[model samples]
Target: MSEVQDSGGEKKKGKKIRAKKHSTHIDMTPMVDLAFLLLTFFLFTTTLSKPKAMPLIMPDVNEVPDPSKQTPVDDEDAMTIILSKNNRVFYYFGIKEPKVEQASFDATKPNSLRKVIIEKKKECESRLKVGGKTPNERHKVVILIKADKDAKYKNMVDVLDEMNINDVPVYAIVDITPKEIEMISGL
Candidate 1:
């Protein structure tokens, strides 16, 4: 009877120990699904903005000179100077055809156009002064400058400085048309 009672007590204790060995696990399926949804939302909703541009203000010329007071003759004195991106300088005098001057610059060297323009300005001024006529009084003494689209800002600035030094004030800038911009952009 004692042996039977001991065996029964040991079996009960073993059953209780087995029952106390418990495990608890949590499911992470919902958290992982939420993370993936947030990633997808960010990937599809963002966009980059276009770059900002600098503003340019050009000089205005509205008043036309009186034709009755002016004498029309063959092209003798009007000058048009063009500065090209390929470092070419062109001049047109009293004619529609332009003459390209053999001129070039080393990208690493200082600009030589400034000196050339200064000399030209002096020549123009001397002609006007010796002839005893002001710029407004002379119809054929005007200087027109047409700069290239890709010319350096510093080069243009040097040109302007030369003009200022020589008292050549009036000038115009050629603009790129909206159609040209569209064609270039393929829009």
Candidate 2:
């Protein structure tokens, strides 16, 4: 706050005269204190964003597969997909050695691998419903993903993404068998 007051000066011709100017003073202490308090309050109340995490389910190395608790996935219900180099995909129903067939990565073409995955999911769900299974019981289409040594990493990622998109619940990346190598090597 500032205030001004007239200062008496020397009288001239018996008339009183006042000084022309007065120094002004201002108080900034309260404003500075309020600014610091607001700053401190905001610093204490603000929350920092936490890093997001992806849910990863790792297989237990020591735990063996229990037979009684495990419901056997029929070979006919299982689909095996093999990713090779040059954007090639080989898949088959049932075991890898006896009945392996080839598929293409192109989604536009008929009989694409994505269509096969959707068909398998529908077939598995329908079969479970016919067997009098409840909604709570998760009957998923089993798919085994095998990648060759020279397979593109992008192709492997794309296959995994397809599994997710198709809602295929039971899928794993398995080692390629010698028979599978020989079967595809003919191409």
Candidate 3:
């Protein structure tokens, strides 16, 4: 709101020869109401986006296998991927042991960890098909992800992304054993 007034000095002649001046006032109530309405509309209609998160299913600690009753995962059906420092990737077809072959990460070439995952999945499917197993009985390719203590978190994330891209059904992050560490250091 605003107002303007004129002083009585303009009639100093005392002849009263002046038109009456009106004080100018502007009502700001409507503008204030409009501003509040817009604020309320935006507050009610605007959507707050939620943050995205990757889905990770962790195994329970109590689910540890009993050595006597547990059946070992077949070497042909399991693939282990080792993540190390400098974004290096090493893999073997089975559990970590001496004489296991090593492979480096190669995004441009077809012979990458990604390729190994795909091939292993196909191989598992074919083996199940030949065995006259039903679809439900077919074995899914199991992937073991082992990260060295010196590896970057980014490298682990990249490997996880590769797992998702390759559609691996069963994969777990396992700690590298002493023997596996020695094998990596020797390489």
Q: What are the clash counts of all predictions, listed in order?
A: 0, 0, 0
User: Would you give me the overall lDDT of model 3?
Assistant: 0.76
Report the poorest 10 consecutive residues by lDDT, candidate 1: 178-187
Top candidate (TM-score): 2
Candidate 2 minimal-lDDT segment of 10 residues: 1-10
User: Candidate 2, TM-score vs. the true structure?
Assistant: 0.63
- Winner on lDDT between 1 and 3 is 3
Candidate 1: where is the Cα deviation over 4 Å? 1-74, 86-88, 104-111, 125-141, 174-187
Q: State the C-alpha lDDT per candidate.
A: 0.55, 0.78, 0.76
Q: How close is candidate 1 to the true structure, as a TM-score?
A: 0.39
Candidate 3, which ten residues in sequence have the lowest lDDT sum?
1-10
Q: For residues 167-186, what per-residue lDDT tens digits would candidate 3 score against the true structure?
A: 88888898898877877786
Give residue 5's lDDT in candidate 1 (0 to 100): 100
> Model 3 off-target regions past 4 Å?
1-51, 62-72, 96-99, 129-132
RMSD of 2: 11.6
